[model samples]
Target: MGDILIVDDERDIRELVADILEDEGYTCRKAANSGECMAEVEKEPPSLMILDIWLKDSDMDGIDILKIAKRDYPGMPVIIISGHGNIEIAVAAIKQGAYDYIEKPFNIDQLMVVIGRAMETSRLRRENVELRRRDVEPPELIGNSPAFRTLKSSLEKVTKSNGRVMLTGPAGSGKELAARYIHANSGRAEHPFVTVGAAAIEPERMEEVLFGRESPERGIEPGLLEQADNGVLFFDEVADMPLGTQSKILRVLVDQTFTRVGGTEKVRVDIRVISSTNRDLTQLAADGIFRQELFHRLAVVPIDVPSLDDRREDIPELASFFLQMFNRQQGLPLRTLSEEATTLLQTTIWPGNIRQLKNMMERVLILSGGKGEIAAAELPGPDAAPADDQGRVVLSGSLATLPLREARELFEREYLLTQINRFGGNISRTASFVGMERSALHRKLKSLGVVTSSKQGARIAHLDEQPAG
Candidate 1:
């Protein structure tokens, strides 16, 4: 829908192509050499480029321009045209990322067809990204407590604008969920809503995963930035992102462009960023662990998600919601929480917030064993021993009277469960705390016959599948 730049040294040839394209209802621009071509592109990237592989009296040739364009503006389709085209040159152009190659004396009809196909191909790629994003169900922001209502009101107000948002909250407090809610409600709802788990991805592969990589061996793998074009890019636990990557992300925020990991050309994107963090970014920035400029850019519309402790009144509703969700998802029988059981849930300390509550509800439903009403006695009790200032639970129980094997099993189960609860049911953190591999911990839990709902089992299986560090 934008201008198409035709690059060639010869005045007549450039004018002819421009005139034909103009007649075909495409706005046309002309560039006589590589320098002019790049200038025009930098000024305003055209939807497509018609490039000449040979340029006379120009500091750089058409092939050089093609390389730069493909590297930087990878999404923009480029058609290489050469007057003295050969098989090798054509192959080279295509390998360098050109959409197609056309020899001199090109057929007018064929040229139009290629142009149409190239533009359509680009459009379809974007549409595919959006479609894939739509396949993911948006997370619901459920709750009617004053804390939750105020949070929803703030989210509704911010969704009307394109301001960058930074969600601050404790782990599992629904920051990522809040970010998704904003994206799903925003004007860019129809586009992709890509998430980058800052802590989940290994540091070595972070750049490649975020900015993508392009090489002859690897071909082209678009990064999260490109996939999130015209949509939202949510950074989960942004404080976990490395400082070096933080600076690069900051540059992208400032310039709206970035080069891939193995690329030299800049890839421009239109994206709205929403980042969430459980850590104190202000203190981190002051300590130089996080970039101050980047933090300010991300926190333009800072919003704090209330912890589960702050909204205990929502527990009964939230518990019921999770119970129904798990039942429907797993095709299990309907179950209800007794008033006493509900009261117990409300009184318990939910260190993991909504996610912990959800997991606990799933466990309760699984353990209910077809009972229509879950009892207070069925629920797992809150932490047995008060955690010291260092968060280490000191158990005050004796297994001296029990047999060795029985005592060992009981101790292991209690210790593991306590540690798991301490870390808010994050298996990875719990594994790290207990000095066990994630898979090993899962196997241990299974061997101990610790009952887990299907959803928790799936999550454990997913964690087990990841390669060990």
Candidate 2:
């Protein structure tokens, strides 16, 4: 339920409106004069305020309250009501922070429309507040490997500026999560961190989602960028955005102002942007699939996330972390990874990075479903080949056979392919079984150029496979 305050000197009008608002699912609180209204406002701010222009007191007007609320509260929305409404006064009221004005001898339908619009705005505002609260609750960014440490330090710098960021990484490398850390740590932490993942959103309708639509019946509303004013707009899978959209978004980056889809007047904003893409954008630009200028604009401080296999040593820690997390979430015993499981986890190449490790532990827990002493047989698949005492792969081949990095890469690629096939190319199930984020797994498949298409979504079945026809 929403908290709403109604202020009017007319007793009949006050009761009638309060009863009507209560019926409409609003928690209605009433005040007979401006004095009481201000007192109620100070006690605790209501979600929406319904104020009558005329009052018993002669000192101030309802428009004065709207101006005061707007100036002090900044984003709070207010609706004005009056028996003395006219076109000129309505326009003036709007200019003075009145969200909308309604004529008294109130039409309940029209009032509902105005209230609905006000409530929507309030809800978005409240959510933005809660999001900011959650963001500031401290660093949830986990990891300590050199790669992770490097990324973490870079993030501190990224959060210190209004500069745009281009997060380039394989899927599930926590690019979005990293972006959140940036925002949460930034000056815009109190503002919204709105996200629109380009790959997740269909290409054909990207415009509507970003800018928004306007039907005559629905009224002219703001878009995502506008909603994110004084905040950050995080675009995930920005590489998947169509070339035309890239140019359009580039224009917004250059000039922080845009008209709504069917609008004429420019709606300006002061916002920061942080975007991510798993694809090689420079190559995409070279191939004419992405705009070079747009890439140049967005890559103000580019962050490249190393693949999971690149940070093999961090696996044991990440696995234990995920296990601890799951243990708490599932309210189960504090289960430790077996020496076998730890070695198995360490030796396997994580195509999906930390996201992959998390998934693996979850599968172990689910398979164990909170049972004791997880064994290699309890694992979803066969033990690592040429197993160590812990059942993890122990490479017997000489380092001379392949460079250390190359051998590691080969091992990880082969291991991921085997797991994918073992799971029948089911990305989510494989992710759960292996311990990785599903998007990270999908990204791993894409980066590995693995292709396994079913009637459902496609995935990488082999690291050496090509993109689909």
Candidate 3:
């Protein structure tokens, strides 16, 4: 049950392979030039590609396409076919990542055998990727509120189709988790689920990272698009992707295929894209930072995840869920929150949404030793400043002895770290509050040697106590 694409400039050859392969119980498709071949591949990558060495009226020759295909879909098998085959060209093709070579007047039995072998290789590689993939527990939405109910209903509809989804929400509002939930319930659940942070990838290397790269000597290095073939690709912070890269991604969304970096062959992929961003994409588009057309394509089925404050009724359930989950994972004793503490949690402004609550619970569990009920008095709050006995800000060492630039750097780092920790490592929230661009904030954090927590373990340090009456 494999799909095979046969690429040959000659009409006779195209028909012959299509007829032969279809008779052999494999789904067969044919293309006349390099463009057609790549178009088919990008729309829905075949298990194997049979390519000609010299493609007439094509942008690139067979060997060139082979290298690009191999790079974009490393596990995909390609068999080189040539009427003008020689030892030198065959050896070169093999070196450039072809699985095997076939001569123009080849035996039917031999070609079928090679096709079977190549299909088997592709199957085995995909199986290996699946086997090595981590079996992570799906994140729970954990809410009984009206807003949550509507969200669940909408998600169910979205999962039934293969439409591109745009998730817009505040940081730590479970956009990635919602995307995962949709993937888990979709038809492609058995396939790979790859995630890429658009902001994290540098603009210079963004193409190579997302679309992959090809080299005659190095073969092909598959990109995230190929890796997410037949499954889901979640792009976190998609608004931060460079404008040029956004255009390339738009092409992929439009045609379901892309050419790799330094290669002319189009690599096809069958992936459902789900992009998320905490920023206002519309505003960014108006400001000319983000592409408006790309935004529209990504927002075909926009879903806005509610902030924690909007769904306060679900706080108790979420808190208890996280408490139990942490207990099991950390091997801590069972714990419960006191009534006063629970009330305080529900009333406070959860700036970092569910993520902040999870962080607070983790901190509380650790601080309370996890054996008994957690009291309101023991909880830590958002503020992160150490004051002296005279109520003055405390500075480590002697600031006056240091140079102005060095002192300023130290203060900036401290301030950013404090705000980041207070917001439970929510970069978007911190950026907005600090009046800095999110990308700029990221650069600053990287330069300052600050590594933020992963989305799964994002934490907001809590206050000492709240006015829980």
Candidate 4:
């Protein structure tokens, strides 16, 4: 049921074992010496290894290779076989991490039984690691707003199919949540759902991280791509991936195969890639920054996740969900948001989207203490400002009465809002006018709670149109 590598210098013995394993419904690869054995392991880690301890005409004997395999891939089970057997050799092999040592004249039934037990033991060890890794429950997509409903509907429609999905939206807008939702409902739900933060990894190590690495000193290290085999691989902020790494990823998407760094053997995988980005990938492709072919391969079904501002109606529901979730997680008594507090949240602008809202709820709960109900005063940031007829904040001498920090914040909020409106809510033009980088201005506007109109957001989304081939 799993791949097994057989290593022995005797050609006849290797073939006999291969034939037996193939008949038993287990995939098998035979190696005549240490070179081939290590090569096979580096190319793709096997589920179990059948190694001959007496490897002739090899630089590293079976025991030497066993140490490296055990050091690098602790999960894989290795069974050492030897023609010349002794108590000391058996004890040495076991000490070096061999699952079991078998003498040459081993009984067929005994060998099969040992293999079965070793496979089961490997499976249990993997499940144990997975359980610890997934102790936190998967995130749920929580909201009932029209925008939220549309996004949820789109995600549901694509679950049965394995189309590569590209989620486009602002940072902290629940793209990863939507990605996890798709993987959980898809056909590959039983397999792994591995995520690679494209921008978070350093450029120098991107290839090694995504494609894996192999070296004489370090042995073999499996990459994220191989880990996501037969499952979903989610790339967060894919636009930030380095150019060289992008090219390598494109090859993997096209051929479903890749080689680890410092290795020549190609390893294949079955994966469904789902990439997310806040930046416009199509524009980058056209500008020759991101590869054009890679864009097409990744954006087979592009879905835009709405910013929190577009889903203000869901604030009360989302707020309550976070509060309840926190209560369960922390073993604290349930708390409720006051009517005024809910209204304040719905009216306020969220630059960081759903993530920011979740964090704010947690902060409120921690500061609420013994209080059962959270009030408007407990909420972070200033209350929603009164807007004049022209949609500008009406200061009304509030600036003079407020502290220096609040007064500066108030002026910046009104100033940025006026400029944003004057520029037709175009973030790029406003950033240019304000002498700031587009990213910095975006962050500044978010901090000031300045909301951009749907039309401007639409214009930004328009940049994702596929370039002419």
What lDDT would each prediction earn against the true structure?
0.81, 0.75, 0.81, 0.82
Better of 1 and 2 by lDDT: 1
- Model 1 residue runs over 4 Å out of place are 1-138, 384-469
- Could you tell me which 10 consecutive residues in candidate 2 have the lowest summed lDDT? 454-463
Local accuracy of candidate 3 as per-residue lDDT tens digits, 1-469:
7898989999998898899889878998899998999899899988899899999999999988998898898888999989898888987987887888899888989999778756754664575366335335554679876567778888999987999999989999999889988988889887877877776556776787778777664468687789899999899999889988888899999999999999998898999999999999999999999999999999999998988866666787898999899888897667888877775676577889989999998888877774677786677744434567897976556775789999987777767765564454568977997899999998777666566763311222234322223
Per model, how many backbone clashes are there? 2, 11, 11, 0
**Residues 1-469, model 4: lDDT tens digits:** 8999999999988888889878999999989988889999999999999999988888999899999999999999999899899878887888788888899977778888879767855764575367436624655888765677789999999988999999999999999889988888888888888888776566886887778876543356577788889999899899989998888898998899999999889999999999999998889999999999999999999999998877765688889999998889886558899988876686577899899999999988777685678888788865466666897877667576999998897777766765564344567877886789999987776665565773443121133342323
What's the lDDT for candidate 1?
0.81
Question: lDDT of candidate 3 vs native?
Answer: 0.81
Residue 172, candidate 1: how far off, in angstroms? Answer: 0.8
State residue 245's C-alpha deviation in candidate 2, in Å: 1.5
* Error in Å for residue 113 of model 2: 23
Number of backbone clashes in candidate 2: 11
Task: Candidate 4: list runs displaced more than 4 Å.
Answer: 1-138, 216-218, 382-469
Give the poorly placed runs of model 2, Cα more than 4 Å off: 1-136, 370-373, 381-383, 386-469
Compose the digit string of candidate 1's lDDT tens values, residues 16-56. 98889898889999999777888999999888999998898
Worst 10 residues of 3 by lDDT: 456-465
Candidate 1 vs candidate 4: the TM-score winner is 4
Candidate 2 root-mean-square deviation in Å: 12.7
**Residue-by-residue lDDT tens digits, candidate 2, 306-341:** 666545546667777777887777865667777676
